[model samples]
Every structure is written in C-alpha cells, then in structure tokens.
Target: MPNTPERPRRISVEDQGPMLVEGPVEVTCADGSVAVSDRFVVAVCTCRRSRMYPWCDTSHRRRVKREENTEAEDGPAS
Candidate 1:
C-alpha cells in the first residue's frame, strides 16, 4: 500500500516565465533522489536566477524587468 499524495496549495504559470509552484511537494531527480520543501508555500523560481535553484528569491522579477531590448525591430507603430 502507498500513502495518499499530498495536495499542493497552489501552482500557476507566470505571465512570461516558469511555472510557479507552492505547497509541499516531493520532488525527484533522474538519480532516484527525492526532496521535500515542506515549508509554507514558496514562490519557486521559474526564471532560473536563484542561488537556490527551484526556489523563488524574487530574482526573476529583476531579470524580467531588465528586458530592455536595444535592437527591437519596429512593430506596428502606435
């Protein structure tokens, strides 16, 4: 027999970035290792800028905010 799966608090996709995941989760890798964040819902970093990978440190916001394209081609002019 196996234990019931724990339900996450919330999971959502950012408007322009990685999927936001919260709540307790049992993450696993190809190496057959597993980890549980068990901590209260955390803003997982989908943008991949955190020193702590897979966890949100609000760094993504900064990365995304700096998307000032210097050579953006002219779109339909307003």
Candidate 2:
C-alpha cells in the first residue's frame, strides 16, 4: 500500500496487472504544482519497482514473465 494515494475516489485492482485509479485525482509534483482532475483510469504500479515512481510502467509485466518462466522451468509435479 506504499502507492496508495490519500483520498482517492476509487482504486481497483486489475486482473493480473496494475491497480486502476480513478476519480478526482489531485497530483502534486516535486515542483509543488497541483493538478486536479476527475476522469478515466490511471494504472498504478503494484510491483514497487516502477521507474515511473507511482505509475505502472509495465514493471509488473516483467514480474509476471519471470514468474511464468520459473513455473515453466520447474515443470510439473512428479
């Protein structure tokens, strides 16, 4: 929950991907400028390894791929 924004209107966990953020989003950058908008979804990173900081820059996909590769390498239970 490190990425949980305060007072988010809605947050949804997408199927096998990032959590989609929606509603009135008030973004405050390091420069101190604020932007408030109520609109569509924003993909929030769940992997905690996004270069984009707070956004889902497809880092989770990499994790998923790694997991899949591990599973494949492990093969079936004997």
Mind sharing the TM-score for model 2? 0.45
Candidate-wise lDDT, in order: 0.60, 0.65
- In terms of lDDT, model 1 sits at 0.60
Q: Assess the local accuracy of residue 4 in candidate 2 as a C-alpha lDDT between 0 and 100.
A: 55
lDDT of 1 by residue, 1-56 (tens): 12246842577877755555565666564477765676655556666687765666
Worst 10 residues of 1 by lDDT: 1-10
Identify the runs in model 1 with alpha carbons over 4 angstroms from their true place: 1-9, 29-33, 63-78
For model 2, residues 1-78, the per-residue Cα lDDT tens digits are 233556546778877688777744666656787645455777766766778755677876643433356556888767
- Model 1 RMSD in angstroms: 9.2
Clashes by residue pair, model 1: none
